[model samples]
Target: MTGGLEWAVTTDGQAVTLRQVAAQAGVSRQTVSNVLNAPERVDPATRLKVRAAIESLGYQPSRTARSLATRQAGLIGYCLARHPGRSLFTDPFLHALTEAIEATGRRLLVFTAPEGAEGLATYADLIAQRAVDAFILSDTVDGDPRHGWLASRGVPFASFGRTWPEQGEQPGRWVDVDGAGACAELVRGLHSAGHDRIAFLGWRDPVPVGAAKDRQRGWRDECRRLGLPEQAAYADSDSMEGAAHAAATLLDAAQPPTAIVAAGDLLAVGVISEVRRRELRPGHDIWVTGFDDSLLATSVEGGLTTVRQPAAEITATLVRLLDAGPGRSGVLLDGRIVSRSSAPLDL
Candidate 1:
């Protein structure tokens, strides 16, 4: 293959052309073009003959020409949100997403857009310039203006998170992990390991929307079902210090929990830090678990028990939704718990 596309030379070492392939296949030039661009429009027998001619002559269609004819940029746009201390390369989800997008023979156009009106304007500019055929959104929140803005314009896009109820009837597809179910499963697993006193450390969101709410709900529901104290749950900012303070509070309470389920890996690290400061073993003295199964979760001193979001599956679903066009129903996929020394399931 030449430049990842089939290229064959004639016996005289001249580059093959569509006209030549058409003559060899005994078809008109338009027929050959239809076979290359819109194969479904051609009869099956003609398509086979054209394909044979293409293969025999080593005729490679021009990607640029096809893109121009179809008005498609063959690119998927993704806005990289600026997280203060995080590197985009370190994000496992984005890595998986990039690979998936590339696998479809399309490139990912990574860009930056500051929050609020500026971000919306950036998206509009990309659309106006035809820089990308569609978009894949992440870090979506309740009443996200981008959703309405894009949907109203009939733009093609899919989100990695749910379109919150507050957004109200926006036309787009989304694929999100079932945070509540994952947290509930963690609770159940911890309960089966003989831990009744469980506490949850989740991010404190002013609006209590999206992942934060869903994950906390799982812990609350499961605790209630098992007759465990649901009052141990605490909310704080999504930071190590915030989690450490919350963990300290939970540990100091009268009848403190023996186990803590943190909403993210960073929070789990904070809990572990506190556990170690007290000269207590993690799994032996106080069980700790986290979500995201991130790099931090695996690199922890003794490893961390956490929820593994199905990144591969999530990206695959997003691609499917994008390919199927807009107005498709959103999908919620479940995450599985990854057990480790911090909270060994074997007790």
Candidate 2:
């Protein structure tokens, strides 16, 4: 192997480091950096010496170390983890978030959960690898430990659909819509439509208490606020199949609900489909509502009534927080109820 060709350039006798390059060039490390970053900042003679030394030593800066110095990676991490058959690509909220994150001069590095992953493994693996400068946590959990872990490690993170706990110290790092408030609005909209027994359909407990859990919490709070019938409350697996089956169960209950507020658009669409299957008119027999404005929401010919959260507004806030170096730590975005055939337009 050694006799074939001596293509190996020996680092043994050459200095391939910034420090060595600077030393050989008879300049400080800062001067060499100035020559590369702001050539005008250094005198012509000094710049020439640094350039010559860099060439002579064949010095190549490590991307990781360079990113550390610049505080920007030109890439952003996006964690995409959900169970099978989930409508990820069809989700408008996620697509909007993706475009928004990309528009900020950063690329999205998606990290999906490996087979059978649970708990904090995603966060740990990402941090350990140091593959991204910061991470975009979509549909994060309430009181999520990932945020705390990132905070302690000083790694930046942003949430899309869900919210984390208030840091008390830094207050604008995460982005979220008012899940609870949106649910309340849906219930009130149903209540005003001559529908008294309104039910909430959500997944009782996802691996992490994601935004669906927040919506369920909203359902509970709204039930207390409006004094609507509570026994009809139900949960699915945050999927269309789960929601469809759950809707059937609700229909079989002793006293079926007249209207349903789904935690997600897919769930609501399932309810709507179920209503039609039962020969019950969507708006009359049972009003249906959803969140996220996903295809499941507006995909129906007449459109499904939903609470629309502005992805641009929330994502801008998140990108701002990340770009500004975690100076702020949390944000609660608002949602608005959109009138459609799925739910009566009482608002």
- Candidate of highest lDDT: 1
How many backbone clashes does every candidate have?
Answer: 0, 8
Report the backbone clash tally of model 1: 0
Error of 2 at 274 (Å): 2.5
TM-score of 1: 0.80
**Sequence-dependent TM-score of model 2:** 0.69
What is the Å distance of residue 142 in model 1 from its true position?
A: 1.0
* Per-residue lDDT of candidate 2, residues 244-299 (tens digit): 88889888898999888887777788888888889999887888888877656668
> What TM-score would each prediction reach against the true structure?
0.80, 0.69
Error of 1 at 181 (Å): 0.3
Candidate 1, 191-272: lDDT as tens digits: 9998999998877657334777778889999999999997554546666777888899999888998999998888889889
Q: Candidate 2, residue 142: CA error in Å? A: 4.7
Task: Give residue 247's error in model 1 in angstroms.
Answer: 0.8
